[model samples]
Target: MENGNGLKIMEKNGLSLNLKLQNGTKVDNGTHWCFRGNKELDTPPEITIRGVLGMLKDSLDPSDPRPTIPLGHGDPSYFPCFRTAEVAEKSIADALHSANFNCYAPTAGLPSARRAVAEHLSADLPYKLIADDVFITVGCTQAIEVALCALARPGANILLPRPGFPIYEARAVYSHLEIRFFDLLPEKGWDVDLNAIEALADENTVAMVIINPGNPCGNVFTYEHLEKVAETARKLGILVISDEVYDHITFGSKPFVPMGVFASIVPVLTLGSISKRWIVPGWRIGWLATNDPNGILKKTRVVDCIKGYLNISVDPTTFNQGALPHILEKTKEDFFQNIINTLEHTSEICYQKLKEIDCITCPHKAEGSMFVMVKLNLGLLEDIKDDMDFCFKLAKEESVIVLPGIVVGLKNWLRISFAIDPCSLEDALGRIKVFCQRHSKQK
Candidate 1:
């Protein structure tokens, strides 16, 4: 190809290579070689939690002496206060030292780990779960991706929650699965907008996703609410993709109810992980269970599809799998309760401190998960244009990172993680309050 300067540019795989002449000598015109990025991956960077967190971290001021307070994403393992149980660490060590799990694990995962997860989750269910019902995943992240792939079809769509996890949309869009959002009523403890679901679904809709003890909202769904959800899915002839990654970490009045409880009413694909409850996200042990008591998933070939996908995918470590039974069976209740108590402390701190800021409005208290979604009153701030602007400026000036709510399908809002130390949580919110005051219209 010829450029404006009349030098020939070589091409490879539809991208411009370095300039060269007929004699094969590289031209010195200083035109750098470049390539295009995948169009499918563009949506993920703008919406994913990790992408936003990385952007916020880059906006930090190098000259600032204070430490960066990360309130953006919900990985609390960074804090010393939220370490995993000793038994969990010991289990992995013992498995590794045994040298029995050095080889690659089965693509679907080791049978023992699968059975352990099945039995562990079965405790909360109305019926028993066999090992075949569960497919171990690298993490809940992979579980969601594989689940979406299994459901994706030509001219198909899925219903999602507003202010929901962006990974659902990212993976869906990547797989060419259409997305239809139904709001979660913040006014009613972020309950599913059943009317909206009824209106949005059609023959092409396959399933609806529900994150109980939610991610950004952190409001646990009541048994009655989940029952209504099951009824709605049944009426629509669709399944429920229940994301219970934050299971049993609840500190709210309403108890944590497994969507598997309603597997008899409708097919529920329940996704869970050791990430949140055990505070070991880096451990990367998770499961995707077909909680259909009637065998609808197997009948529909959905379980087969999931297995096919996992066949080509990477498995969690063999040693981790070998240790999972001990980890699940031996970990004491105190370790779990300690996490809940710490989260409760930080949640209260987030609620009270967010109240002190005029520009931020938190609709519901965080009762389960590490995050709480708050609406941004952009009108109250003199210079802040939107949630992204507020977060970027906050990161640059205060060294505090927060997530823009638009990434999670809500505009003019922010999602904050209260999963850090209590002191750090208070300090970060205090900085946010000062930032708001400094940028206030009255100021």
Candidate 2:
């Protein structure tokens, strides 16, 4: 018999584990349950990109007449020039109206969507990938979490790139995985210090991660360099996690090479998304692929572990998955090249403009990605304490924004995004120059 409210009370071994409610108050078994969050988890310092950007925005005065120039983050969707391709928008509309994709997607992914991602990635790889080798994620962020959690066994540690994307560090911390930092040499165009990685790894080391056409630093890895990275991971007896979100957008002397190209040497876990290339981050479609041509991931049960994690996790929207095939196939090369050309022009403008400021120095010219990491010469400034101070002051005084390098594990530097229109970039840079001069020690 059901209750008067049409509810059916269930029991598990004489205990429901669910509290009954009466008059909006929970009725307990002579004692109320105290549900609390896990207190054992380590909370990271609240210097995340979003957190810091929020603080900087809060520091701004509303009375200021100038428009806020956002160079702090990499989202370019607000800019008219960086709008996504027309075909991509049409694909989403078509998928929504088709009435065939309103149903729930499989936990792993829609089979055809998985196959399309595999085929797209396999075009650059020697060995083909089956649908089982790919798992769709809400975005690359979720893919990062899945990869980290899968590798987060007891006492297992993961190596991360320094001055890197903060999301990896955040996810690793949340997954309770030990993190070891491997420096990317800014003097060498931000190449990884392989020697440091050698000293950091042991039997417990699970994987090493690299972001190509890197975030924070806009250096693209050469084919030779990537080959060496794969070899190093092989020698260390660890798999490589390559993030190719900025794939094929190179405008440098080097080309964008996928780590899967070297899967023959070692196993690789690749995280990628259409957010960067297609310029539709809001759509939130990404994937994780196990590029284990040697079948090591399968032999070691890593693939099974990843699948298990996906079975209980959130997935990309089904309609987005339905539209993904068209987004990947129908989108022409010309659309991609146009964005590349725009980034090339904007990156050039960023590199040159930073050179004009006395206190800020960009060590390397940006090549592929949307940002450039530059050092802050605090001695040249009068009142600023560090990178954070510089950013806060710039936001308040000049109405321009930039990211503090300390937010990405480096101090006394800044991460400036050049993905805006050329005129806005120039205007923002000019304001930065003025702000620097205003605070100059000589002044």
User: How many clashing pairs per prediction, in order?
Assistant: 0, 0
Which tens-of-lDDT digit does each residue in 184-302 have in candidate 2? 99899999998999999999999999999899899898888888998899999999999999989789888888999999998999999999898888889999999998899989888
The list of candidate 1 runs beyond 4 A from truth reads 1-37
**TM-scores of all predicted structures:** 0.92, 0.91
Candidate 1 residue 282 C-alpha distance from true site, Å: 0.9
- Worst-scoring 10-residue span by lDDT in model 2: 18-27
Model 1: how far is 316 from its true place, Å? 0.8
Range of the 10 consecutive residues with the lowest summed lDDT in candidate 1: 27-36
Per residue, candidate 1 scores C-alpha lDDT tens digits across 374-439 of: 999888889999999999999999999999999888999999999999999999999999999999
lDDT of 2 at 214: 93
- Each model's lDDT comes to 0.92, 0.89
Residue 432 CA error for candidate 2 (Å)?
Answer: 0.4
Candidate 2 pairs with clashing backbones: none
